[model samples]
Every structure is written in C-alpha cells, then in structure tokens.
Target: MLSAQHINKSFSGVQVLHDVHFSLLAGEVHALLGENGAGKSTLLKTLFGMYRPDSGTLSVAGTPVVLGSPKDAQAQGIAMIHQELALIPELSVAQNVLLGNEGRELLNYGRMQARVRPFLEQVGLNVHPATPVKRLTIAQQQMVEIARAVARQARIIIMDEPTSSLTTHEIGQLYRVVRDLTARGVGIIYVSHHFDEIEELADRVTVLRDGRYIGTVRQRDVTQDQLVTMMVGRELVAQTAPPERTPGAVRLDVRGLSSNVFREVSLQVRAGEVVTLAGLIGAGRTEVLRAIYGADPSTGGEVRLEGVLMSRRTPADMMGRGVGFIAEDRRHQGIVPDARVSVNMMLTSWAKGKVGVGERDMLRAVEPQIQQLGIRPANPHQIIRRLSGGNQQKVILGRWLSAGCDLLLIDEPTRGIDVASKADIYALIDDLARSGVAVLMVSSELPEVLRLSDRILVMREGRLAGELARADASEERILALATGVHTHAKDPAVA
Candidate 1:
C-alpha cells in the first residue's frame, strides 16, 4: 500500500541515502537488512515524515502523496515503532493507548479502558488496562507499543529491532501478533540484526550497504550466509577462538546483592580474565551488573575491589574504588551526543583530575587518545552525535580506558553496533585484559560470549543458574542454561 521512488536524503553535507527506491504491499512483511549507518533508519524516517526527502516520489495505493509531518503520515495510515520505545512510564495501558486524540468533552476513564481492552487481547497481552507501564517487563512494554499501533488502525507498521531485547518465547508471541496483523491485511516493515528471524517472518528481504541498495531476494531462494554476503559484500570471517586464561587474584567480589528487580546474588571476577554474564532478557543480568557498579541501588550487598570492602555507595563512589561501568544504553546513559569528540574523550579523565591545569595541556591529553582509538573524522572538535554509532561507542570506551579503572563492568558491548566495529571493540577489550584489568561483560549474543569470555555465568529468573569455563561453554550449553535445556552430549566446537 506504501511506495517510494528514487528517494534521496543527506545529513550535514554527508549523503546518507542515495537513489533509494522501496515499496510495501498489503499483508507482506518486508525485511530491511543492513549494517549500522546503511541508511535503513534514514529511509524509514523519511517515509514517516520525520524528514522530507530532497528528491523522491511517495505514493500510497497508486496515488502520489506528501507526508510533511507525523500527523500527515498517521493520517495516511503509516505508523512506526522506534527502536527506543516511546511509552510514558507513569501512564496506564489504557491512558497510553488513547493518548493521541482522546475522545470528546470529558476524558472517559471507563470508555478509555474499554477501548484498550480489545486491542490488548488482540495482541495477547494479559496486562490490566489500569496497570502502570513502568511495572511491566520489556516484552510487555513492547506489546503495549504494538497495541498502540493496532489501536491506531495503521495499515503499514515499521518495527525496528522489535525482537532484539525479547526472549525466545516472547519473540514467538510477537511473531504471532505480526502474523495476525498480516492476516488482517496489514503490511509490516521488519528491521533486525538477527538474520534467522528474517527467514522465519519475512516474505522478501532487501539489503542495503554504505547508503546504497545491494539487492532484494525472496526468502525461500536464499540462505542466511548468502544474505550476509549480500548485505556486507564479503564473507563473514569465522569468529571462533579458543578462550585463553591467565587469571590472577579476585578483582571484584559481591556478596548477597539485593535490588528491587534482583535477588541476593553474588559473583566474582579475577584479573586478566573475561567473565561473561549470559541470560534471557529480564533475567536480571543487567541489574546485577548495574547494582555492583552503583548505577542502581542495592539493598543488601557488600561489593569488594581487590579485597577492600565497599559499602552502599553511588556511581562516583564506585568509580573512586577503581571500578568502571559501560552501560548498555549508550545513547541515553553513556555519552553526550551533541558534545565534541575531545570533550567526550576527556569526560572520565577530567572528572578524575587527569586533564591538565592549562587548556593546551588538556587538549594534548585528549588528542593522543582520540587518535590512538582511531575515532573517525578524527577532528577533536567534531560533534560526537555526527559520528557513526560504532565510533561513538569507541569514544566512550576511550574515555573509560583513559581513566585507568582496574575493573570494567560492561553491558551489551556490541548491541546495535556494526560487525567491523565489533571486531575493534573486542581487540580493545583483549588489550585491557593483557594490561591485567578484570572485565565482566554481559551480552545477549551467544557467539560473543563464546568467542571473547574466559568464563561464562548464566542467570535464570533472578538467580545464578550456573557457571562454566570457556573450555566447557558452547552455544548449546549457554542456550540450554539460558533457556532451561538439559543435555549430556557436549559440543566440541564451543568456541
């Protein structure tokens, strides 16, 4: 029902999309596959009226159209669910569902709930209409987002990484919802990092690379490896490496860690060792790391660094104790997007008295590190927001490494980043380990855990399910632990 012809878009003199042509038909789920910065999001935004394409023709159902604003797009039956969900935490499901264009004179609570009830049921959500959204899990919150779209009666829905943070079971539920939407003649634009999902949910796939269209193919005609080759224009390097260990004394220790979202969990990491925390989403993996780093409050836990006991404290206190934290949400929690590269690079150091007294000295301190980290467009004054997502993450990591923390607690080191940059990030982390730093990484990608970690720890339902040596952990083993599978047969190709 939606179509675009010869679309073109740019940002700050850089061409992000060029001669991009795309279309969607009723009841077809079209998968858009690409690396980060491939203009996938830009194309979606242009169609959704967030940006006016410099030159292109858009049509809906054979008639040319202009979507000058979000309202205009919505009026045209187009809806987009952003990668970052837009639900207001304090609002109830009913309130959020009826947010835009709430009915007449008085806002009718009973009518609002009644209006939302069927949509919730249609999406298979068991949430109460009156329940606050903040209390719901990520999967439930995502359902609320989908329900909102359904309530709007959108004909074309764009879902960006919809299953990135969802569990296997939750993904199945979402797939059913998508299938149901398609059955009712709705079209879907699916974007994701996982290619397997594309095979499962998509009718056709289009690949984009470096802001240009590579090609499109029928799902049944191509394999996953072929899709990757088209999207990247290269064979994916075999990413298997036997885990190495030269571990030393304990670097970080936690005893009886308790938080509002997590229970009394304890863990440890040693110097020169990479410990990975693996679990299904909402298994309290991120919470455990955050609590130890003092980003979130821990009700009852004694955190120790190098045998020194740390009391209940804040992030600053944790940093002062030789601990570093790389939060999962880099956009919101990690870096100042609008600031210059040098400023972001010096953020952690300036806080720790590493920046020099004079302006010249401080500039000197920032320049070398930025260059060493290979931050692209290496101009120190370049705004970080202008850089690619992977480059932004590198600057953030450069800031942390400059601060010289002995212990690093990182969350989702590769989420939403490109594959080439993922390799660089792995190298950086490996170098940190060679320097005798203890690294505790939490990732959802099974291959990453197998490739980079010296040891792996699995969590289930807010508890430590089990721990395995790198030699012993396989994708199957980690999956079994994460998904509650029991198997006696061991896979030799663990790495």
Candidate 2:
C-alpha cells in the first residue's frame, strides 16, 4: 500500500535516517522496532507527511507522490496515531473524530454525532458520540483516535506505542480492533518496545539501530534475544535477584493514607530500601504516589519523614525535606518541554533557592549526570522535547539525582522506555538504593517489579491487599494478590 526507498533525513545537520527503506502491504501489520533514538519516529513521521526526507522516493499504490503535509498524507489514505494523545479534551468525541473533515458547513451537532457514531462503533468504542473526550479513559481515547483514522478511510495507519498505557484487557480489545482493520484490508505500521505485542500482532518486524536499518525478519523466525542483539548489538544479561540488604531506619512512613481513589493505605520504606507498589491499572498506585508527594489531596493520613511528622505536605515542602518525585506522566507533569536539558535537570535545584546559578553554571553542574545517564545527543543545551521518550525519562531521573534527594517517589519509572534504557534505569535505581536513597515506586509490569523490588506491595481496589518479600514474590503470587484471589496455602506474608 505504501513504500519509501533510499530515505535519508537529518536534523540540524545530524543525520537521523540513512538510506532507510520501508514498505507496507495491504491487510498486513508491519512492526517497526528500535531503541529510543533509532529513527523510528522520524521514519513514521516521514511516511505520515509530518517530515520530508532529504533524499527519498515515496510511492503509494505504484504511483510516486510528494506529501507536503499531514493533509496530503490523509488524502492519500494515510493517518498516524501518536503515543501522546492529540484529542482536544473539551471537544465531544464526534467533534474530534470529524474535526478537519467536518467541512466548512454550519455546525450540526446531531448530524455530526450521527455521521461519527458508525466509526466509533467500528473501533468498539461504546461511548456516546456527544460525550466529552476527557471523560473517557485512555484506552477509550485511543479507540477514538482509531475511529478517526477509520473515518478518514485510511488504507495505511501508523500506531506508535498504542498499548503503552493500556491494561491487559484493554490491550486484548486493541488486538481485536487491529485484526478487524487488517481483515478489511487496512495496512498498519505498528511501533512498540514490547516484544510480546510485536510477536502477537506483527507479520514482519523491521529493526533500526542508531538511525540505521538493521534488518527485517518474520516474527516467528526470530527470537526476542536475536532482536535484542540486532537492536543493541548485545546479548543483555538477564536481570537477576538483587542482593539482600539490611535497610536502615524508616525514611518514609505513611499511616492510614486516604484519598479519593484509595483508602487507608499504610506503608513504610526504610532508608536504602526499594519498595514497589504493584497493581493493575486504576488500582490507585499513582494516586498513592501523588498523595505521598503532596501532588494530590489526602483526605486523611500522616506522612512522616524519618519520624518527623510532615504537617505541611506540599511539593516544595517535600523537596525541601530531601524528597523527590518522578511522575508517571512524563510529558505533562515531569518535563518542561520548551526547556533545555540543563534547565530541566536543574529545576529542583532552582526550586530550592538556587536561583542565582547562571545557565552556564547549571549546564556545568548537570553535565556529569547527563553523561552518566547516557542522554543521547550528549548536549546539555539541546531542547529536551526533541529527545526520545527513554532519553526524556533519563533526564527526569537526572533531575532528582542532581537534586541529591534522600527519598525518591517514582511512578512507572520505565513506562514507555526501551529495553536497554530500562536496564540503565534499573541499575540507576539499584545504585540509588545502595547509596541509601529510599525508593518507593509503582509499576504495572510484573517482571520489572520482580526484578527491582526489595519488597512488593500489591494493591487491589485502591487498598493494599498483601505484601511479599523479594524471596516470596512471583508473578503468580503478585497477580493473585492484585486480583483478590486467595492462595490455597495460607501464606504468613500476605495480609
């Protein structure tokens, strides 16, 4: 349905794509796999007409074409769904679905909803067309995006990390939608860091490494280990059980913490310990973290830092008391998109009354951390928004590391990060714990929780259902706790 040959793209004189070639056949799901800065986004943008290659030829249905904008691509039966959602929050679902294509005609709410309802149904989104988009969950919003693409009659669609924020059940729904689209002869170019998704959905997998095409292979023909080797030219060591440590005095103590989403959550993280909150989506893990950091209002609770009651639990108060928070929503809550890497990294320091530090001094101070975290482009002056998701996450971690906080509250630390970057983050967290920085984290990925946590606390229905030490923690046990299924054996650790 679409093809690009000899594609080369550069940004600010730095080449990002080199003689890259990609093709999509009708009714097939072609997956594009890569690490954070491996040119995946650039290639997708090129295909979707958000970017023009320096040297390349794009052909649609055997005819050469030049796409000057996304409109041109849409006219040529191509659409893209970005990882960060693009729908207007206040707009109705129908309005967003038929946004540009609504024509210059007079507004007709009834007609608009009627026309957009079929597309919504086609994507299995059950909400009323007139419903406000912000009221829908992330999964529903994604379906709305797909509904819009389907409404455009797009023959080719690019989905970037569509399941990054979805739960297991929601992911299954997405798979069904993809299959339905493919059955209707719609071609898809899927991008994700999750190998299991690619293995399930992709007919063929093409890999890019450091802006260069590595190779393409049939999904069933290659192991994940082989793909990892292609991605990083490495056989990464599997994460093993962390060594046992005797944690120091309690650093963060939450007693009967209650919020709108959760109730009476009590937990303690000792100095030098890594305590992970494990749960399904909407289990209030994020709210708990936010409440602890004073980002969310707590109806009741006492948060103590090293036995001192924190009567005023504001963000500045927590930061002043040697606490740092890494938010789950990196795009909105965690980063200053317009700021330079140095500025974003030094935000905490500046907030703590280091306002006299000049830009040069800030850059010099954060340079070591930037290098240590392996932030790509390696330029402190670079705008952080231009970096990949994994690199952006690294900068956020660098922010806290530079702040030299004693306690860290991290939520989904590696949510959208690639594998190599995830390992880097894991090592960094381990290092922090070893250095006596108390770590409290929330993670939905079972493997990550198992790999990193000194202790796992499972939350179900916004409450702590049980707790498991590192030795007793397993995927099955954690799920049992999370899903509220009683284990046959009476385990003392479970509460």
Candidate 3:
C-alpha cells in the first residue's frame, strides 16, 4: 500500500534515519523491530508526514506522494495510532470516533452514534456509544481508536506498542480486531518491543539498528534470536536470576495496609533485600507502592521503618526519612523534562537540603553515576527531554542515588526501556541491594518478577494472593497467583 526508499532524517545536526527503506502491502501486517533509539518512531513519523524526510522517495499504490502533514497522509488513506494514544478524554466514544467526519452542517448526535456503531462492533468495542472516553479502559480506548481508523476507511494503519499496557485477554481481543481488519484488506505497520506479539501477528518483519535498515525477513524464516541480533547488532546476553541473599534488619514494614483500591495488605522488605510485587496492571501493585512511599496515603494502615512507626508520610516526609520513589508514570511524575541532566540528577540532593552546594561539585559527583549507569553521550548537561526513554529512566535512578535512599520504592523501572537498558537497570537494582539498600519494586513483566527479585509477592484484585521465594518462583505460579487460581500440576521450580 505504501513504501519509502532511501529515507534519511535528522534533527539538531543528529541523523536519526540513514538510508532507511520500508514498505507495506494492502493486506499485510509488517512488524518494525528496533531498540528505543533505533529509528522506529522516526520512520513511522516520516511515513505519517509528522517529519519531512531529509532525502527519501515515498509511493502510494505505485504513485509518488509528498506528504506535508498528517492530513495529506490521511488523504492517501494512511493513518497512525501512536503508542501514547491521543484520544480526547472528555469526549464520548461515538463522538471521538466521528470527531472530524461529523456532518458538515447539522450537529446530529443520533446520526453520528448510529454511524459509529458498526465500526465499534467490528472492533468488538462493546462499550456504550455515549460513554465518555475517559471512562473506558486502555484496551477499550485502543479498540475505539481502531474503530475510528476503520470509520476513516484507512487502507494502512500504523499501530505503535498497542499491547504494551494490555492484559493477555485484551491482547487476544486486539488480535481478533486485527484479523477482522486484515480480512477487509487493511495493511498494518505494527511496532512493539514484545517478541511474542510479533511472532504471532506479523507476516513479515523488518529490523532497524542505529538509524540504518538492517534487513527484512519472513517471520517463519527468521528466528527470534536472529531478529534480536539484527536489531541490537550483537549477541545479546540473557539476564540470569539474581543471586540469593540473606534478609537483614526490617526496613519497610506495612501491617494491615488499607487503601481505596486494596485492603488488609501486609508486606515487608529487609535491608539489602529485593522484594518485588508482581501482578496484572490493575492488581493494585502500583497503589501499594504509592501508599508505602506516602505519595498516596493509605486510608487505614501503619507503615514502620526500622521498627519505628511514622507520624507524617507524605512524599516530602518520606524523602526526609531516607526513602525514595520512582513512580509509575515517569514523564509526568518522575523527572523534569526541560531541565539539564546535571540539574535533574541533583533534584533529590536539593530536596534533601543541598541548596548551598556548588554546581560543579554536584556535576562531579554525578559524572561517575552517569558513567556507571551508561547514560548516552556521556554528557551530564543534555536536556532530559532530548534523551531516549532508557536514558530518561537512568536519570530517575540517578536522582534516587543522589538522595542516598536507604529504602527505594520503584514501579516498573523498565516499562518502555530497551533490552540493553533493561539489563543495566537490573544490574543497578542488584548493586543497590548489595550496598545494603532496601528495595521494594512493582513490575508487570513476569520475567522481570522472576529474574531480579529475591522474593515475589503476587497481588490479585486488592489483596496478596500468594508469595514465593526466588528458588520456588515460576511464571506459571506467579500468573496463577495474579489471577487468583491454583493448579496441582508440578512446575519445575516446585518439582
């Protein structure tokens, strides 16, 4: 349906895409594989007219096309759904679906709802047409986006990380929708970090590395190992399970923790111990972390640190008490985007009364951590916004490190980071624990839960369903606990 040849794009003297080539067919799902900064997003934006390529030729149905804006791409029957969805939260589902396509003259609510009904049904989005988009779940909202794309009669749809936040069941629903669209001859450009998703959904796959086109292969012909090698340009090492450690003095103790979302929850982390909270997206793991960090105060609970009951438990209070937190929403909650890396890195120190300290001293101190954490370009003055997703997360870790936190509450430290960055973060977590810092983490990735955690606590609905030692944990056991179920079959760990 669409193709680009010899594409080259750059920003601020930095070349982001170099001699890149990509193509999509009328009814094919093409998977784009890459690390965070491997030019995947740039390529998608180039196709969608968000960025005019420095040098490239694009064709639609064998006719050359120059797209100056997204409207031009839309005119050619091309549409893109960004990873971070752009739905208007306050608008109703039907309204969002027919936003621009609403009739020219008359404000016809009934007609619009009727028009959107078939598209919604096609995508299996069974929510009320009049329900506000904000009221829908992420997966439901995603289906609504698909419904809107189908309403627009887009021949090719670009989906970026569509299943990142979705549950397994939600992913199945999306696969069904994709099947329906493909049946109607719609081409899809699928971008994701998930190997399994690509293996299942993509017919052909293209790999990009360091802004250059690596190669393209049919899914059946190329193994996952080959894909990884091409995207990263190396034989990537696998992360092994963390080493065992003896639990030291209790650091964070939550007894009878009760919040609006969860109730009667109790957990503990010891000095030099790493305890991971594992569950589904809405299983209340993040909420539990928030309550412990005092970002969201629990309704009824007592949190003790080192056998001392706390009076005040706000974020400021927690920071003052040698506790640091990395929130779930990193962009909005964790880091200051506009600030320089040196300034952002020292935020925790400033919070802990580093007002009179010299800027040179601060920069000098963080330079080693920056080197240690592998923040790219080795420049401590780069704007946080300019860094890739992985580097941004490293800055968040740097902030906590500067604060000298005795106890850290981290949520999804590797949510959107790439594979290599994930390894760095995992190593840092182990280093922190070995340095006698208590770590309480919440992660949705099951492999992460099983790999880095010395102990795993599985939450379901709003309570702790089960706990497993590192020696006893398995993916099936963790998932069973997360879903509030148990089977008698022997897993290797249990066996």
Candidate 4:
C-alpha cells in the first residue's frame, strides 16, 4: 500500500538513516526488527510524516507524494500508535478518540460516545466510552490507541511495541484485531522485539542495524538466531540461569503489607538474591511494589530493613535507606523528559542529599555508569528523553547504581526493550545480585521469571497465591498459581 526508497535522514549534522528502504503491501503485516538506536523510530516517524526525510522517495498506490506534517499523512490514510502513550489523562476515552476527527461543530457528547464505542469494541477494549483516560491501565490505553486508529479509518497503520504492556489474553485479543484489520485489506507495519509475535503476525520481516537496512526476509524463511545476527551483526549470546549461590542476611522484610489493591502480604529478600513476583495483569503485583517503595499509601503494613522497623516510609525515606525503585510506567513516573542524561542518572543520589558533590564530579561519576550500562549516544549530557526506550531504561538502572542502592525494586525491567538490550539488562541484574544487592522484580514474561529468579512468588487477585523455587518453576506452574488453578505450599523462607 505504501513504499519508501533510499530514505536518508539526518539530524543536526548527524546522519541517522542511510539509504533505508521499506514497503508494505495491502493486507500484509510487515515486521520491522531492530535494536535500540537502529533508526526504527526514525524511519517510522518519517513514514508517518512526523519527520521529512532528508532524501528519499515516498509513494502511495504508485503516486509520488510529499507529506509535510502528521495531518498530511493522516489525510493520506496513515496513522501511528506510539509505544509511549499520547492520550490526555483528564479527557474521557470518547473525547480522546474523537478529538481531531470531530470538526468544528456543535455540542454532542452522546454522539461522540456512540461514534467511538464501536471502535473500542472492535479493539476489545471494554471500558465505558466516558471513562477518563487516566483511569485505564497501560494495556488498556494501548488498546484505546488502536481503537483510535481504527476510528481514523486509516488504511496504513503503524504499531510500535503494541503488546509490551499487555497480558497474554490481551495479546490474543490484539492478534485478533490485527487479523481482522488485514482481512479488510488494511496494511500494517508491526514493530516489536518479540520473535514469537513476529512469527505469529508478520508476513515479511525487515532488519535494520545502526540506521542502515540490513535485509528483509519472509517470516517463515528465517530463524530467530538469524534475525538476531542480522540486527546486531554478531552471534547474540543467550542468557542462562545464574549459578547457584547462598543468600546472606535479609535486606528487606515486609510483614502484613496491606493496600487498597492488595491484602496483607509478607515477603523477604536476602542479600545477593533475586526474587521475582509473577502474576497476570491486575493481580496486585505492582501495588505490592508501590506500597513497599512508598509511592502509594499502605493502610496497614510494616517494612523493615536489616531488622530495624521503618516507622516513616516515604519515597525519600526509602531512598535514604539505600532502596531504589524502577517504576513500570517509565514515561510518566520514571523519567525527567527535559533533563540531560547525567541529571536523570544522578536524581536518586541528589534526592538523598548528595547535592554537595560538584557538578563536574557528578558528571564524571555518571559517565562510568553510562558506559557500564551501554546507554546509547554514550554522552552524559545527551537529553534522556531523546534516547530509545531500552536506553532510557538503562539510564534508570544507572541512577540506582550511582545512588549505591543495596535493595532494588524493579517492575517490568525490559518492557519495550529489544532482544539484545534485554540480554544486557539481564546480565546487569545478575551482576547486581552477584554483587550482594537484593533484587525484587515484577515481570509479566514467564520466561524472564524462570531465567532470573532465585525464587518465584505468585500473586492472584489481591493476595499471595504461592511460591516456587527456581528449579521448580515453569510457565505452566506459574500460570496455575496466577490463575488459581493450583497453589504451591508457602516457602518457609517467605512465611
């Protein structure tokens, strides 16, 4: 349906895209595969008219066209659903969906909901049309984005990391939506790090590395290893389970932790150990982390660090105690979009009264962590917001490292990250555990839980359902516990 040839884009004397080529066929889902900073986002923005390529030729249905702005692209039936959500928090779902489409007209709230409801249902989003966008979960907001695209009736749709935050069931729903759209002759550009997703949804896969087109192949014609090699230009080392180790003194202790979303829950993490919280979306796993980090209020609970009860537990108090939290909603809660990388990485340390350090000293200290984490652009002065999702996540990890956190609470650590970056993050987490940092993580990906966890704790609804040792855990067992099909006996360590 759409094609671009020899696309070259540059920003501020730095060339990002070099002779990139892409094409999409009517009724076909084309997958774009690339690591962070591989120019995938840049290419997508060019296609969507958010950026005009420095040199290229774009054609729609065999006719040459120049799209100057997003509105121009939308007029040409193109729509982009970004990984970072763009919905206004205070606006209702229907209002957000119909925002630009609704022309200068008279009042019609009832009509707006009626017009948007079908699109919502088509995308399997069940929330009321009048519900505020802020009330929806990340996954639901993603579906709303898809629904908005459908509402736009765009023949060419671009989805960036659409399933990053979705549950397994939600992913199935999205697959159905994609199939339906394709059945109607809509062309889609699917961007993801997941091989399984590409295998299921894509017809042709294109690989890009460092802003250059690597190659394109049929999905069924290429193995995952081959694709990895194409994207990173090397034999990607697989992440294996860490070597067995004995944990040391307990670093964190939560007893009778109660919140609006979760019941009394108790867990403990020892030094040099990784404990992962495994459960489906809305299983109260995130709530537990927030309560522990003091980001959200806990009605009844007590948190202790090294046998000392923490009477006043606020985010600042936790930071002072060498506790670090990596929030799941990175775009909203984790990053300072306007700040430079050095500033964002030093936020925790500064918050803990480390501001006495000179600016040059702080930048010097942050430089090593930046390199250690492989944060792209590798410049401490680069604006944190300009980096890709994976790189931004690395910066967050660097922040905790700079603060010298002994206890880390990480939620969905690799969400929206590419496979190569995921391996890097896994290695970093393993290194942290080996260095005697206690790590408690929440992950929706079962493979990640099995790969990293020394112990797995499952939550269902609002309570702890079961726990399993690393050797005893599997996707089936985790699902069983998460869905209440079966519950393992409580581990004495956690009890």
Q: Write the per-residue lDDT of candidate 3 for residues 1-495, one digit (tens) a residue.
A: 799999999766778899999999878899998876788888998899988999989999999999889989988999888777879999999888887877741277777788889999899988888899999999999988898898889999999889877999999999988888888899999988888989889999999887899998998898888888888888888789766877799999999999999998999899999999998889899999998888886899899998889867888888888998998777789888888888888888887885336877887778998998888646787777766777888988988887799999999989877777788899999999999999999998989888889999989899998889888888988988887666676754223
**lDDT of model number 3:** 0.87
Backbone collision count in every prediction? 0, 0, 0, 0
After the best TM-score superposition of candidate 1, give how far the Cα of residue 300 lies from its true spot, in angstroms.
3.1
lDDT by residue for model 2 (8-120), tens: 99877778899898989999999998898888988999998999899989999999999888999999999899999989999999999998989642298888888998998
Checking candidate 3 for backbone clashes, the offending pairs are none
Q: What ranges in model 4 sit over 4 Å off?
A: 104-106, 117-121, 124-128, 134-140, 353-359, 487-495
Q: After superposition, how far is residue 366 of candidate 3 from its true place, in Å?
A: 4.3
Per-residue lDDT for 1-495 in model 4, tens only?
Answer: 899999999765667899999999999999999999898998999999999999989998888899899998998889999987889989999888877987532168888888888899888889999999999988788888888888888999999998887877778988999999999999999999989999999999999998999999999999999999999999987778879867999999999999989998999999999999998888999999998988899999899998989878998888888899999988889999988888899888787776446788787789888888888878787777777889999999988887788899999999888989999999999999999999999999888999899999999999998888988787878888888665364534233
TM-score for all models, in order of appearance: 0.90, 0.97, 0.94, 0.94
lDDT of 2 at 329: 88
By summed lDDT, which 10 consecutive residues of candidate 4 come out lowest? 486-495
Give a tens-digit lDDT track for model 1, residues 155-208.
Answer: 999998887678788999999999999999999999987777888899988888
Evaluated against the true structure, the overall lDDT of model 2 is 0.91
List candidate 1 stretches off by more than 4 Å.
260-264, 356-389, 479-485, 488-495
Best by lDDT: 2
Candidates by lDDT, descending order: 2, 4, 3, 1
- Cα lDDT over the full model 4: 0.89
Q: How do all the candidates rank in terms of TM-score, highest first?
A: 2, 3, 4, 1
